[model samples]
Target chain A: MIEVQNISFAYKKRTPVLKDFSLSIAPGGIYGLLGRNGAGKSTLLYLIAGLLKPDDGKVLFNGVDTRLRKPSSVSDIFIVPEEFDLPSISLKKYLSLNSRFYPNFSEEDLHRHLDTFELTPDLNLGALSMGQKKKAFMCFALACNTPLLLLDEPTNGLDIPGKSRFRKFIVSSMNDERTILISTHQVRDIDRILDYIIITETNRVLFDQPVSKILSRLKFMTTDKQQLIEDALYSQPSVGGANIILPNTDDIDTELNLESLFEFALVNPQALIDAFTNNINA
Target chain B: MIDNRFRISRTFDLFRLYIIENRKFLLICAAAIVGILICVAISIASDVSYKRAYSMYRPDLDPAIPYLVPTYIIIGYIFAALGASFMFSELKSKQGRIRTLMVPANSSEKLISRMLVYVVLYTVFYVLAICIAEFFRDIYLMAKMTVAPVTPLYTIFGNEAAINFLTTDKYPILLPCILFVGVFAIQSFFVLGSTLWYKYSSVKTFALFFALFFFYTISVFMLGSSLSEGKTYNNLDHFMSNYFGYVFLCFEIIVCLFNWCMAWWRLRETDVITTKR
Candidate 1:
């Protein structure tokens, strides 16, 4: 549903953030964007939303240029940033103002979700805590029911329960017509709902693969022995034992460790790509 | 694929949002207006008498009708407060991201709504305050002159001079309203600048106004210079009052457009994740 073509951006001279970076998301997938600090993930998402004018290339939504006619092109598109504020009015007023701008807003869905968040229509948003504010905005975004939803660091201040509630909301709030892009450094918080993962480093997408494809292409393990398993593409140890990723062979059943896969993709990218490509044809 | 249902005009909701956001404060403004008008009416009725409202005799100089600048200042202050308080509400804090970016309207829509609140709603109330003051002042004047033969109603504000001020002469009622709206549109930018800068945001708000000065100074300066033959800034008054009035209406429209697009550019790319202050 979203197409970004050969886009490159820089905040300052000679300090390239995203160089020749591009990614396309089809309709209905929940994309997890993984990158370290200052990785330009937020910049990329804003480019798609037509919030930022790209230095080069174009972000196209259904064949229309986003930057040139952003309002016309992406009025149905919504972005929820990590740090967001609400108007000082009650939630009822806030929803009225926002929902009018979004023709697709579902008041029934809104009522249901607001109850799930335990937020009343009468509460003034200015007085709510950060987590409460986040929940309220998330509820609104879901109610907007737009075709494209871009959430940046959506789980930052969320409490433990808030995080679990967020996971539930993210999964339940989707349909076949919508695309959700969640960008975060807090990888563990949203691993379960991430059907596809995109890792950015060195101004390029080192890994762009599905969880199932990644699991089939490679294996994850924690072995007490520190033997040189040369067949393994990459290895990193945690507290108890060494966690290794290698080519999946035979009929061995092993779970995928996203964190390890992300690390392996960053350190040994070629091997990671080769394993995925090899399995794609197999 | 879902239908294309997002419309840019949706940002106009900010107009209603702006009023609702300050609905309590607006009622407070209306109260402030009502209170001040009552006090002025009482003071003029009790202390100065009707002879003073229409024709205040200086005994030495000609009679000068008091133009109630204090009332103007009070009315100006309330609307100025409304504009000042919310100018940067969406851009200054985390709420800026939540309200401006996530809504279906886009950045331009958000900005346009804010400008509408400042120029249209606030200025309308300003004129309302003046009308209320004049209406009650007329009643007080009429009541005080019940015993006298020379009713001040002949030359009062809404009397012959009031109707003739526009209908008989060149200036239409639309002239003043246009001027007020146009001047306030330019003044709204001062609030926008406050949003861009943090230290400026915490200042006294409505009590602190460059908006008033900007409005008054431009009008006076333009009028004054135009009257002078050699002045570079021609008085807009020189144009037919109706034509000048139309110019202001057009100017206000353009300003509203500019305000929205500028706000959109500022907000569309905002990193709400880092916008927390």
Candidate 2:
């Protein structure tokens, strides 16, 4: 579990990336942190991983301040940054050097994840292409078995098949004790696998709810009828029709459409918040 | 509860990992040192041969020994200083910083492991490289001066100048102790500067060091001139003659400790994405 308490951070001489932001993430679910570019999603992840200290307030992992970066706290958390470099060494050598730090590291789990990604254990990391390297790094990160995994842009640079396999790999690695927080702009790549959705902007969280809650409150559909578009809380044009989010007054269970929901959050954030909190009428 | 912050086992693991990651770079540095020293030896041999042919050769002395000592010292210091300054080069880039800081080791452990590699292990490697270079130098000289008198190979340990520099009368072991402390203090300054500026750390550290040294020298000169104006400082001479060495040695030790502490503090506060604190 992680808690972000009134944290503020900014890059040098730039506008504040996050101002008085607060968030709490409980264990066991895959959290999809969605935000547009420069919306402080990745900054939040880095702060949670203790790679960056907050300008004010604190981020705590299981009641311990993450910024302290104690060995005990760090061993339980693994972060795969959006851009990273693996040493020019064999996969086996790299694992041998790094896996010892994580007490729960499992070679068997590593092999399983690699298999899901259609990769083998015997890999010369330096010789692999960028996508292959990312797959390899992701597999290793999953195998670390840390309780908290922070992934920034996990699905970037992946082939279509690789993206599907990544979803499978993440699902297979999930357990009751582990929490995976993924920050990405590519919503379609991970939307199906996420248990919870959190959409944030420059200084505020627009929406935070479980997928089931989102589905139970708002209905997503594509229709050409202008009547439905007028009644919908949010609507956007699509290929054959318009994608719309309507109030689920009849308790109709519709699948959560992440892309439409993300756009809806950005366009009409107040209505989205009202639909969840005040129960919008049909 | 046991202190997990500074576990010896974890420190050893980190030390091993650093060596494994940097093995290629270390090999290249060792090769360069040996190659440069061999070239210097060959040049000395050529100069000796030229002198012999021109009938200006001194047969009693080995010209290479005098030059080799200073060459080894100067080159060794440069290599060590650069290595110390580059000790935190992994923190220069976002990716490197992430990998380094995310490792499950305390800040002290990380700093200590890197110091072992860039400071302690580098000294060991430099000594070995110099010895190997000396062996090759001796062989080349023997081959080049077959008809001329060939002095024995210079032994670093037994050399009179080295012995005198390392040991002194009155304070026999204090000389080498002070020398090591002084060297460590200088290296620590570079390491501290490395943490301050990650990119081009060595160049920045060198520039900053010289600038500070210049200002420090000026301040000392002005202060001394003003304080000693119209004052007969008779005890100053005696104090300088008797206790200056001890005072300077203590100062070096303090400086060394301070720089190391500051470097560790900076490293602990490092952020993966930010260049500025």
Candidate 3:
């Protein structure tokens, strides 16, 4: 579990990216953090992981302030950034040297995950292509068995098959005691895997709700009718009609459309927030 | 209730990582030293006539010892600077810095482990390389003894004359001891500078060092001229030997301690973006 309490952060001489921002994440389930460029998505992840210090306020991981970077807290959390350089050593050697720091690291799980990605421990990490390296890193990260896992743009370098495998690996590795937070602009890549969504704007959180709650208040549908199109909260023209978001007055179950939801949140933020809040409170 | 910040086992883990990660770089540095030493030996021993003539002339003069002393000092400092840069190479990029910071050790553990690698281990490896190079060079000289036999003593033991000169009270063991502390001070400055600048840190630190040295030199020169009480050069020289040596020793120790503490502070304050910037 993690709590980011009223945190404000700014890069040197730049306007603040996060201002008076606060959010709490409970244990278990995948969280999708969605934002446009410079929305401080990666910055927030770094703050939670204790790689960056907040200008004001603090981030607490399971009640321990992350900024202190205590070994117990740090060892229990892992972050896989969009881009990282692996040491120029074999994966076996890397695991030997680094895995000991995490008391719960499982070599068996590492091998299993590597097998899912069609990788082996004997491979030289530095020689792998970027996508392959990402796979190796993800496998190792999962194998660490950390309670908190933060991933930034994990699917950026992954191919279609790699992406499918990534989703599978994540699903198979999920447990009741762990929290995985993934921040990305590529909604389609991780949309189905996410249980909760947090959409951020430049300096505030636009929406934070579960998929169930979002689906309960809003309907994602396509319609060609003029009346329906006019009344919809957000709509985008599609092949046969217009894809739209409207109030779920019928209380019908429907699949969550992440791309449309993201667009709808950005366009009609207050409406989305009110719909979710009203329904949940009621 | 679980805290492992200053634990000895974790520090050992860090040092283990440092050694395993940097083994290749250390080997390459050692090879380079040996290669340079062999080249120097070959150049000295190529001409049979010169080797014979040089051997005949000086029983008291071992050519290698004179060269080795300065080489030892220069190479020692050079390796220290290189080691400092290598220690913080992770801060050079966004991804590297993240990986480094997320290594599950506290900043203090990371700092001390790297200091052990770059300072302590580097010094050890440097001395070993020098010893190995001297052994080969001595063997080569003994084989090439045509006229007068070139004494095959290791460079440290030089000839009797050089040994006497090095051990003399005027230039005693205390001087080298002070110089050793001075070397530590210089190294501390470099290691601290490495934490401050991420890109081209060595070059930038070197330039900064020389710029400060120039200013300090001018200030010291001016101060010395103004502060001198019209004493003769001999009297000043005696005063330096008697009292100034202790003062300089204290200065070196302070420099070492100050810069080392500053290095720790810089490392502690370093964040992902500050290092990248």
Instruction: Report the number of the highest-lDDT candidate.
Output: 2
Tens digit of lDDT per residue, candidate 3, span A106-220?
9999999999999978999879999999999999999999999999999999989999889989988899999999999889888888989999998898989888877878888
Q: What is the TM-score of each candidate against the true structure?
A: 0.75, 0.91, 0.91
Encode model 2's per-residue lDDT on B139-195: one tens digit a residue: 876665455443433464445544543455666667666666766877988999889
**Stretches > 4 Å off in candidate 3:** A12-14, A225-227, A279-282, B41-63, B146-162, B215-228, B232-240, B275-277
Could you tell me which 10 consecutive residues in candidate 1 chain B have the lowest summed lDDT? B56-65
* lDDT preference between candidates 1 and 2, better one: 2
Candidate that scores best on DockQ: 3
Error of 3 at B61 (Å): 5.2
Per-residue lDDT of A129-214 in model 1, one digit per residue for the tens? 99998888889888988888889999998898888878888888878898889999888889888888999885788888887777
RMSD of 2: 3.7
**Where does candidate 1 stray beyond 4 Å?**
A68-73, A88-93, A111-127, A228-231, A278-282, B1-12, B24-65, B69-89, B94-98, B106-112, B134-158, B161-277
The better candidate by TM-score, 1 or 2, is: 2
Worst 10 residues of 2 chain A by lDDT: A273-282
Q: Enumerate the candidates' DockQ scores in order.
A: 0.26, 0.54, 0.56
How many angstroms is residue B223 displaced in model 1 relative to the true structure, after the best TM-score fit? Answer: 14
Clashing residue pairs in candidate 3 (N, C-alpha, C atoms within 3 angstroms): none
